[model samples]
Target: MPRSWVDGLEARARASLPAPVHEYVAHGAGAGTSRDEAAAAWRDVRFLPHVLHDVTDVGLATEVLGTRLETPVGVAPTSLQRAVHPDGELAMARATAAAGGLMVVSSNAGSTFADIAATGVAWWLQVYLPSDRTLALPLLERAVAAGARAVVLTVDTPVVGSWEPAGDRVWDVVDPAFTRVNFDEGHDTQPGAEKALDLGPHDLDWLAERTGLPVVAKGVLRADDARRCVQAGAAAVWVSNHGGRQLDRAVAPARALPAIVRELADDDAEVYVDGGLGSGTDVLAALGLGADAAFLGRLPLWALVEGEHGVGRLQDRIRAELVEAMRLAGCRRVADARDVVGSPAPV
Candidate 1:
């Protein structure tokens, strides 16, 4: 009901969550420059509203990778949802299904892949391949067995990036051992998270060749990088700077769209984006710039604070806001979003 659903959600989260949990969800990588840049880039997009078009019957339904989604926004994989709420990833899946969108389950999920799939949420697994490829295959196989439709291979963190999570009250209570439950109970941290996979630029082709499921490369920000991924047989290229968690001075995923879109315009793989997108307007901006889908990373943390209900409410409100944006722009469909273009149209 508020003018900005995210503002109220953020306020509530700040008031309720401990300082450390809040910091983990809020702060970006070193100096927080890219985090700021990503949000600003969306503000730079301006829709070309057609005052004459009839938008009385606007539509948001769209399809991606041969699957239907009610809206183009998706839930991105975030680690340690257990640290935020009891339901965590399952709650996120339920909310996403309810919202008619997809959820990319994190490799560090507190729940197992089969368990998340059981919620009837069409989910893809976000995998961080360790230095050893052998350890990665079983995880992929397990995800497919559990009905994962795609594998969102997270390539930004070949090795974990450094960031000191804020506050100490969390560590004083929450076990450092409790974050990961998707793997062996004895494996306290994510198994393959720390080492490089020795992956060639074309190595993704090798991985995709072995799997029955589609392999989507996430964390790409350059058109050249995106082009290489397409050549590597990536089913999709997700434009992300790891939500600005890895690199400090990186470009925002939304700002990188024009170049990446141009490179992959003729390619089969769709371009997905994430980082600093917290509202439907932000989602609309990404769509207008040619992103097939936009993933909400930090916003979901606010939703997960109240479990699935919060997520559902946030999602419902976002779709509503998207419809409003379409109506004001005099756009009748998702495809119309592209009409906005990179530069403002002639006055």
Candidate 2:
């Protein structure tokens, strides 16, 4: 069989990158059970197609947090992007903008928020509040001033998760500019500058109130947690397990989605999910299970191996596949993808 898009990109990225860098990008916490199982979970979704319906004009248009998108799929934030390509997040911004997709920028981005905004991609800032919460104020202020449309507050990490010994990590040797360049000083090591261990729902309210921008609660895997986040002024809830980079054995986003979606069924808030979503059919499964949109993480990063052109190619392929999937599933618009998820037939 011809190689799938994800496998082809992963092969190219691995060939182009240093061994340590590829390991850093590909490895998950602990033994990698969560990371390893995520993609398989999405692939297991069985779509219940509505046959005999018009599919000649399947479209992927949708909106997220009030921003219009040509496609429902967007780029999920990933750190240390410069380690993968010289152009880094800038290339991602330009390519995503060209494709009319959203780009959620990592707090540890290699480029400044201003430069990213200058790429003209509709973007959101992903934030990890430091122990000295006040220290994050300046960075958050700068991002808002630079045109960040929303704040994606990652709430699952109180500390970095442990990865099994995998030789020297890439963060140790890359240029500081290839790491976090948004801070005013080298605050990554400053006293009280570590990730806050005492984060709470109140921080969600704080982020929204301070930035005057909507907040998305990222990394939530439970219905109660998601509910608390929405009640705390979150405009959206992102179902993720940090791409299995966080706690090992954590439920995959595909498995964790239905509960949260059911929990928020009557609420006005939008629900989004990410983690091992590789194909257009996977995106459709997410929508069929009540996700407003799906986000791509590792696939796009691997595509970044060729800079803007590569990522652009990845985006075009996914868009085409998604349209084809929709056509086969009888979904003419994004909204029609709902309630189509069902159990796969047994062999």
lDDT of each: 0.80, 0.89
- Give the per-residue lDDT of model 2 (tens digit) for 1-347: 22276568888889989877888889899989999989898888898888999888877789999999999999999987988999999999999999999999998999999999999999999999988888898889889999999999999999889886643567566776786788878677778898999999899999989999999999999999999998989999999999899899998898889889989999999999999988888888889888998999998899999999989988888888888888888889999999677763121
Please give each candidate's TM-score.
0.93, 0.96
Candidate 1 lDDT by residue in tens digits, 119-177: 88888888776665666767777787898888888878765556666444567655554
Determine which window of 10 residues in candidate 1 has minimal summed lDDT.
Answer: 338-347
C-alpha lDDT of residue 127 in model 1: 78
TM-score of 2: 0.96
